[model samples]
Target: MTRVVFLLVPQVHLLDLAGPAQVFSTAADLGLDYRTEYVADREDVPTAQGLPLRAGTEWPDLESGDLVLVPGWRSPKTAGGPRLTDAQVAQVQAHHARGGTVGSVCSGAFALGQAGLLDGRRCTTHHSLQDELARRFPAATVERDRLFTTDGRVVTSAGIASGIDLALHLVAVRHGPAAAAQIAREMVVYARRGGDAAQDSAMLRHRSHLSDAVHRVQDLIDVRFAEPLRLADLASAAGVSERTLTRRFTESTGLTPLRYQSVLRLERAEHLIAQGSPVESAARAVGFGDARMLRRLRSARFQS
Candidate 1:
């Protein structure tokens, strides 16, 4: 059995808390022995919408679980409440040390960050707070655009509705892809977007800092993913050795030039597929050349 604790604070986002609760409750309906209880520092927690949630468990009486989700808090600029006090911090830290999976939605990342759980971890928060979060926590690698990021057992998601996406992803990880797909279908939400998709978007956003030559090469590749890319020509156009371009591109983006380009093509192909294009035509349009090859790749990477 997996027990999930929802740590509620003053002015929590009601929907953010409910989204995961719904997903896990569905898991229970499917005959999984999962339990969820609302816990708080006090017996009463208020929602940002001015609704009140009645906490069923007291903080010290709460037991560690297989997972815990903290919904976003009201912005510091907007709400007044206790910062995660010393006891709350120690409780969450102890849960992590016991190999429990923990995560947050939106500003709940602040609670996790404050507890020292996000140090040296990659995390994303609501975009509005990205700068302040980065400045406040130098050890965390703040990702600006992802809806969610999961490094090992600690996961974090971006603003408001993205909490649903993160919850679905956790379902995929905890149960299985088939189970997650079924849940998404039942919930009328899109299937979980793979982590690779999130990484590619983040990498491309950071690519502008590369040399002018690199940007030029990337631009050509972006506009012509269906065409053959020549490493020598790309290097020549950038006025750098192939090795130099590769190293710098990888360092800046965390992906080699070729892998990044392939991801771009795949992303386009996926869009085409979603628009009802025939698989073979979409593959050819993306430089994959064969529908079978694309199928194999999708199965290997995303099990679609």
Candidate 2:
């Protein structure tokens, strides 16, 4: 089981905390073996929105597989969110020292910077705080206009609702795209928003439609895109005639079922190739019989 611990700060933005918590909790509910925990420096914490919350003062046992996230809080200038205590900073640093992932959203990046985890790493936070974060942490390379960024084990997100995207990205990494999609579906979020320019894949795109039949077929195809699948098989899975499936699928996603699968394969192949895999190996890994078809698809993808 993976433990997802949220380190809550005073004046925390509710959505920054709730969004990711809901994601991991929903994943747990879906039998994903995820355990969510909340820890705070004090027993009672006040939020920027004026609501009060109670959290555990005692921390839990965590390993490398576990993740610790510091949700963003109101900026220090406005209400002066308290900084992480020295001991708490030590704990956060120690977790990373032990090879565990430590993440943040918005102003929470300041806490991570206090822990010295942002040194020489590319990270981001809420746009409003980007200049201050960069000024405060001169050693850190703070990026702008990113939903989230991962450099080694330290990750950071832009802010607010983007936390959901960050949590979904983490789920997809530990599990798979299909698992993330299911959790998003259960949460009633469109599957995802692209993390960045190059990171856009079929898994994140082509999920804006509300058709139950198309979504069901997409769920199946997402999990088995690397396999040899037939039109009859896909139509049968959707419980629709081949012709009707074709029409609806096209109307919903603007791609035929087979074409959707090909897009998936092409995207995955591109990722593998970018990671230094040979053309032939990447092609075969994403379900193509040979590099010839993958090359043709690559040419077509770039041209169109």
Candidate 3:
């Protein structure tokens, strides 16, 4: 079993710890070989959420394939948050030196920086701290807008909920996209966000609209984006005329039905290609009749 050790700093944000913990725990429930433990320099640490969490004071004996994650704590702007000891910092550095992967969520990047892991590496933290991180670690490359960044064996995430995304990404890397998708579906997450800094999945990006008609149409397209879909059928399911559905969907999501489906297809094709599928195979797998159109679309999208 792969061991995932979480270093719980004082005044840690609950969601920063809970989100990724839940992902791994759920993966284990699905029969993945994962074991989780919580460790801290002190036996009991107070959280920013007004609860005290108990943890082991001793670090576990970790080996290759083990992961150590530092969850974010209360902002340094506020007083009385936890600080890592010299011993704990050394432990993190030693783990990375021994080929173990190290990760951080939000301000946990500060701890990793203190461990000297951030030097000469590309990483990220919560957007609010990006400037401070860059200033503190002059040699580190801090990406300000990314949800996360992984350089070598180190991974760091932007903020609280992004931890779940980071963890799911690790699951995909370790297992496969299918496994990550299964875990995401079981978690009721609509779709996994890609690592791209500027864009999120269409379902998430367009979900803020309050139109029932548009939402119904989106639900249909999201599930069967790889299949041929008729606008009239989508309109009927949404209890609207085709023209009305078109107008409302465009108003809400800024994309027509066909365009929305194309985006999903392109996203899937990119994933397949990243997994080593040939362009032709990925194109066919995502419902393109041939690679020519896929190539054209990809070039057009990238250029624009």
Candidate 4:
């Protein structure tokens, strides 16, 4: 089993801790081999919400494939927000040194910085603290207005709800996009938004609608994006006419069905190209007959 240990700081923001915890918890409920726990420097920690939280004072033994997360706390500008002690910071560093993944949410990036994990690596924090984080840690590359950033084994997320997206991204990395989508659906999240350009999977990016018909159609397309699809079949699956499906899918996702498939194919082709596959081979693998149309679509997508 993979252990997901959260380090609780005094005056911790509830959502910053709970959001990601819920993601992993839900994954466990869905039969993923994840074990979640909470730890802190002290046994009783006060929360920003005026509640007291109990946690383990001792650190658990962690190995490779385990995760250590630091959730954001009350701002430095506020009273009662505790900073990580030198000992706590060392714990985070040691976990990463042992090949465990470390992550932070919002202002929790400060803890990671103190541990030297953010040095010379790309990361992010809440928008309100972006400038201050940069000023405090000059060597860390702070990205503004991102949902999250993954630099090697260190992951950082923006304020509040973006933690859910970050955790879902971790799930997608470990399991698959299909598993992440199922978790989002069970949690009633509309869609997973991207960070810093189109870093989210196509299933996530195109899943912001409330229509069950559209969601069913998107589910099919998500798994079979590389295969040829017919409008009549898609419409039939959604129990709608072809024209209605086109209009509704456009209104909900801002893309026609064929256009959505093309975007997925384009994204896969780009990934293949990045992995050292030839353009022609990548195009053929994604169901395109040749590289000509793929090149044209890539240029048009990038230019537009």
Q: Give the TM-scores of the predictions, in the order they appear.
A: 0.65, 0.65, 0.71, 0.66
**Cα lDDT of model 3 by residue, 229-271, tens digit:** 9988999999999999999999998988899899888878887
Mark the regions of model 2 whose C-alpha exceeds 4 Å error after superposition.
Answer: 197-304
Off by over 4 Å in 1: 59-65, 78-82, 196-304
Q: For every model in order, what is the number of clashing pairs?
A: 0, 0, 0, 0
- Write model 1 residue lDDT over 1-304, tens digit each, in one string: 7888888888898888988888788878877677887888888887889989899655434344478788887785455333677877887888888887889988888888889989999998887878878877899998877889998679998857788778778887778777877777777775456532342352266575746766877777777767888888878877899999898777766777787777777777786887579989999988987898778767776854
- Kindly list the per-residue Cα lDDT of model 4 for residues 53-140, writing each as its tens digit: 9999889899989999999998955552467888898889888998999999999998888888899999999888888889888999
Model 3, which residues run further than 4 Å from truth?
A: 1-4, 11-36, 46-52, 60-67, 73-87, 90-101, 114-116, 126-138, 144-148, 158-199
Residue 82 shift from truth in candidate 1, angstroms: 5.3
Candidate 4 residue pairs in backbone clash: none
Off by over 4 Å in 4: 78-81, 197-304
Pairs clashing within candidate 3: none
lDDT scores in order: 0.78, 0.89, 0.89, 0.89
Worst 10 residues of 3 by lDDT: 194-203
